[model samples]
Target: MLQSIRSASQHWLGKIVLSVIFTFLIAGVAIFGVEEFFRGGSSSTVVTVGKTPISAEEVRTAYQNQLQRYQAQMKRTLTPDQARAMGLERQVLAQLVTEAALDQKTTDLGLAVSDAAVLRAIQDEPSFKNANGTFDRTLFYQTLQRAGLNEPMFVREQRSVIARLQLADSIVSELPVPQAVREAVHRYSTERRAAAVLSLAPSAAGEIPAPTDEELTAYYDNNKASYRAPEYRSLNLLVLEPEALAKPEEVTEEDARTAYQANQSRFGKPERRTIQQISFPDEAAAKEARARIESGEEPFEAVAAARGLDPKQLDLGTLAKSELFDPAVGNAAFALEQGKVSEPVKGRFGTVLLRVTAIEPGSIKPFEEVKDEVRKEVALRRVRESGFDKAQDAIEDARAAAKPLAEIAKERGLTLATIPAVDAQGNDPSGQSVTGIPDKETTLPAAFRADVGNDTEALRTKSGGAIWYDVVKIDPSREKTLAEVRDAVVQGWTKAETDRRLVAKSKELTERLEKGEAIETLAQETGLPLKEVTEIGRSQSKDDLSPEIVERIFTTPVGKAASAPSGDGRAVFRVTAATMPAFVPGTTTDGQLVNSLRTALADDVLGEFISEVQKSAGVKVNQTAFRRALGGEY
Candidate 1:
């Protein structure tokens, strides 16, 4: 099932990196001198997936894209060294394997997309549309060009993406969230109780009787596995942030002036034009209307009204020249002498006559206009460069004084801030960017271990950053104290109790049902609420079931009784129900069925093709090469 799901999602790799990553990296393209195209290098062979050979070039492109995504999102640098450590190169090669495996499968199955369908899909994409809601060929071409893709490459990529989606939909559509499963999920997601939960906190119980020497010995013997600590290594780390290089002292008035002057365009507004338009179905109509205006007998609006047009209806007043239609359209309008009407101008939306009512000239903004912003920028840069030493000294003094980070910040007039929980993978809150610094070449901080004590002095970093960590006190491994294991033990105990109670209850209920006890009566006796859920289908929301209790009810035979453990040791059940999901009457004949059948047929035969490729290709993975490229041991 997992392999099928993974194969189904083959498109994820080529779906374009997230826009957030793109935004950050695209902006700094000039800073790193990163080339978009694959540069020629001594070609190296990588693992081949099926019959298709995965080239060093392919792996490099994928790796580079991954690096850019990390850097752009994290606003840090990523070096090739760390990539080698994570087996990233091998991972890319694996992706190529998976893709080739699936593509061959697709080809062998004879599944196909028509040129007409591809064209329609392209037209439907919102990114390719003009303001008038039709595909703009020039804009579409330009966008692809910027992304370093050509028409054929883009189309081929799209074909694979669509094919992959078809494959996924085939599997997912068949596996309807079974009504029973849906009910279970719904109950789990939505059911809430007003019970006053009192935590049996071990802390509130006080220093547990310093376990008698005998008790400690017994526990160690019974659960020796709990006492082993995970292997850990302490490493010196270096961190370099943008602010580390910025120094307020180094930002002279002259320097500020120069920066302000050099980036003058950033402070200036684009040239704007206030314009109006009138459209006609064809150029002949537009020309005829223009003749009436030149003859002085008909007003533009009057002639338009007579021709069954609402002259004011299409008024797009005061649009910035850049915002007005396309460049061809806007240029035509701007070039026309003020108050003079343009000749029939052909555009993607048809022909139109444009009149420029006003022109707002573009001008360089005075430094005074953006002085406060410049000052802030200048100050920040300077502080980054000069304040590092002060920050370092402050940290050292704080350690000696045993003062808190807040106290040190207070004295230094700098803010002390906290970053929220980062995961073991180094992911941020969004569960992306395995390294907290997205752009930087860093891996998970191997220094952070479960054993690292809380409230320790700031751990200095190699990147010029420091972490004044108070490890959030997670449950320790077996090697830690017994008190740390108490919660898990109690949780296990409760679950076991619930299961035992539920099994007995189910037996009792089944017996009573055989003897004809009313379901309502049983509910009343047991103090369990009896409620009827209607239209329960394969797609039922899990919230309605409360901890998966509904699965037993739905799966039970209609005339039989069943009970399941639910919510904190409570047992829940139903005696019988006549209604259960079979099939919607017309769905078998629906177009959806045809599509599903096509997909299933394709997937079934795909494995044979992959096997054939495997037989043909002599594939070997150079684990050492991969590890070296990624920068660490495989």
Candidate 2:
């Protein structure tokens, strides 16, 4: 069942099972003579591992799930070409092949789950339980039906999954990590250092002379790709949102009244009372307590206090009549006047005396009082429920009839937005950000992928809207003339020259500091400000020191100088001190680091085990079948 699968995915055992399966499936197993595998005739089987065959349908299903996951993560739809370029098809095939190899190995080893064990696993699943916490046969069957599985199929799949898990656990569970390994990791993560740093600004390079026309032209030629334009598409988009389409003015009085009458609960509040009660073992005890309160020998609070119940324990807060679990107690509580206590009443749990401290009478707004609000609600609901679908159908009909999107939008009183030109990143030719594109993250990618005059599916927006777009024209990418980008070329040439000079200058200064020159003396001579940074960790970066500089500092030995590129300049740093903090045992941090190392070690062992299994069993792929599974030609 889908619910059971989801619930299992969150458990530790389930995570391990899934991790092992996916690890083998997508580990990029080396295939020998791949081209020869494509020479065979087409078959429904995509791969064969030992005696087991992996069907193309299985690969197709796995690929589609993988594709949907990727789309969800990226929040955008990918075209077929994009998917292929991302090597999704190859990954999917490799995953299935590896899984099949493992399954074959499990079979050879005589690993199997008993039918009783499979039944127990299904019965133990929380998703199949009823309200009383017992497994429900109807719920179990219904869940399997929704998941498109029969009892036999589900039981078989469960058996296979458990067998695979057993194989993986035998290889990876209880694997030990060495104490030295934990110490090494801790030292690397906890080491700290101090450094003397001097920042070199662009001015330190000292005025890069203007480039010659020839030099600029040479730079432009070398970096022509940087100055080239990206392909752009001009699109006509028609977006329909329910809220925007809803016309409150069109809603009649009759319609508003009908909606108001149909949804009375939405326009009114039920009467509520602040009540409290004290339960007794029997009706006699409840009556005795009420009699004592009535005789003024003890108040309700005193009586509750005598029973060792606090005010909070006695108070049930405010509630409507339907909120009370016991109808007898609810009726008695509501019938009592404010500041009055009722006689003993038999409730579902036991006999109880009820008290009402406050009452709030329910009220409903008249139709005339909420006419406009009701009308707006009805209009929006209509558009959301049915109007949007009808409008989409009409637009689709027009599109099927070969009518242009812009004309159809105009005829339907919808806004037709025309993007003059936009690139894959939603940027115009001038590199300015384009605005007003609905669902830009999903739409732009789909638009750039579609060809002019092609029928493309409408994209759905996050706000429950649909966007239909037509590619009007596509501008092919081309190299810009040198004259057209002269300014950018000159700027690039200057920055490159400046960086070269800065590197040389920093190298010269670094050598002097490393030899014998004091950092303060060099700072005074260069007229650059110098600062000392202390307690810099391997993972930390300061405002003046970037992560790269921090890494350089750690790599440099004490009393040595290193240079790294900084923001628009360079920084020469000298290591002044290095410290390795004492590693405390049994701390939370130490435990976490040890556990992570253990997990990594286990993964390595598991990977090696699977690799050996694949080698022993022998794996073969039918490249033609694999390609066909992805709807592609070999």
Candidate 3:
């Protein structure tokens, strides 16, 4: 049966949110920000959350950002084609759709966070806490700036993020699994069945008949998509990885010595000192405490405690100059000789009285002690230099030669490898399979673009490490010859035939049922066994019916028939009987286990809601524009 045409505005809105439900709605909102700016025509919006449109640009940007983040986190680089093959693009856009829906929901409900709340949240964050244990406004501003968000925009965005969180919380909090329901679910989950095992192996039936040309053709026609070869790209790339140019074993004693000597300041010892502090709630109290300490009878600890001050609270430890809070404090502490007490000094937080407890002079490690470490650094540097020289030579040669890429690679002792095909969308032919030569990274260059953007000349490109590539061949997507797709066409035809037969059978059964045929008799007539589902509730049928199937079953009246031709010509069913299953108290260990199992199972499936806002908005992607944006002449 065809899926119901979801023409309702709510249903379409839900679809948009379905795309980017993960980054939450914030990503969708951000996508909403720059989506309209794309040149040519805007990419279709998969979803829209509210009146805010989420275009293809939004999904694409979000996807690219997500991919880049993933690459950076994994410390790997992806070729343009490799990224597409992995369906990083589609998956990313899908997530954006989810986000778009959530965003719409948020808007519909009028959920919002205030700017002040966002500011407070930022100020309260421990990461922004400065030495004084308070949110340093400057640091907070600077950090936001570093994150590419100015104060106002960050606060505004953060407010929205918090609002979205509130909405999520409301959704989650209201989703309660009742105790009785949970227990019942647990029982079903723990329920075990006894069965006589049987195996029907295809191998046991030796030499299965060769499919007739008609059967093959039918199968191929039915499953043509599966058999069509995926888009493939052959690319040449240039890469510059630090490891490729540097080797650890190339440092000489002289090189090590020279390296260590030239950078001796970096290896020098930190100057150490001791200091004391007198902290107070107010500067007046701190000044008075200092005065008493200077006047001599009051011990620093006693005076501090009498003033209800914590002596260790504000004290800078006996630390190296590099560790000191202020340059003045460091200078004064280091200047004092051993056992000398210094005058009271005013500092950032409070007045401080300093005393030099002991002086530890700075010293560098002996050359012999650090020789090994120095040698490693020197050797690595040499390797990098040598590698760069070699890479430069290769680039020069490639640039000068009209020779084939394979020959150039062979001459330079580099292996030539082919990259998997990427579609105009930059998706891989394999659809995100992790299997490949050199495991994707070594084989794919960061700049391995198949389109080459109208540039005919092969240019040097650098990726994560020293791996370099030369574009050998660029194969554009083209209609395959019948010979190439004959097998696929046959498979598709077979599947289609199977489906047609199943549909006819289902229709015949439905007509018989309408004519007063019983379900048991129908089951016997067909080979499908009746599934004896006892004491089953709508929730317990989660495994049997995914959310989609479960919803359909519940919507059907108890006595009404509900059957759908599922995948591979399989038909599904739900039988309504005069007698409902009654709960049986625990009679054995297995029964008790079943009860516990049901409860645990109930905990697993709860609170799933979606809104598709994009379809409602009638978003359309300009495929031509998208390909152009991808630097491809589609």
C-alpha RMSD values across all candidates: 12.0, 6.4, 13.3
Q: Evaluate model 1: give its lDDT.
A: 0.53
Q: Candidate 3 residues 1-634, lDDT tens each? A: 0001111223222232222254333343243334441223334544433465656455555655666676776666655655666656545544545544556667778877776787776777665666657777667676666555576766655565556556654544334334576456555444432111111122222333456777675555555566555446655544444454555566777878888888664577756766665545665665676677668867677875775557665356668876775666677677877765555566555556566766777788777888878877776566565666677666557756655556656666655655545433445654564333332443443334434432343322233244444444466555555568775565555445556656656666667765667767776665455555443354444334444334445555555555553334334454453233344445564365554543333223211344334444323334455554444522
* Candidate 1 ranges beyond 4 A from true positions: 1-44, 47-55, 69-87, 94-240, 244-352, 355-370, 378-444, 449-507, 542-544, 580-589, 596-611, 614-634
TM of each candidate vs. truth: 0.53, 0.76, 0.49
**Predictions ranked by TM-score, top down?**
2, 1, 3
Model 2 compared with the native: what TM-score?
0.76
lDDT of 2: 0.81
Residues 427-471 of candidate 2 have per-residue lDDT tens digits of 999999999899887899789878999998877777778899999
The lowest-lDDT stretch of 10 consecutive residues in candidate 3 is 1-10
In order, candidate lDDTs are 0.53, 0.81, 0.53
Q: Which candidate is the best by TM-score?
A: 2
Model 1 — TM-score against the truth?
A: 0.53
Model 3 TM-score is: 0.49
Judging by lDDT against the true structure, name the best candidate. Answer: 2
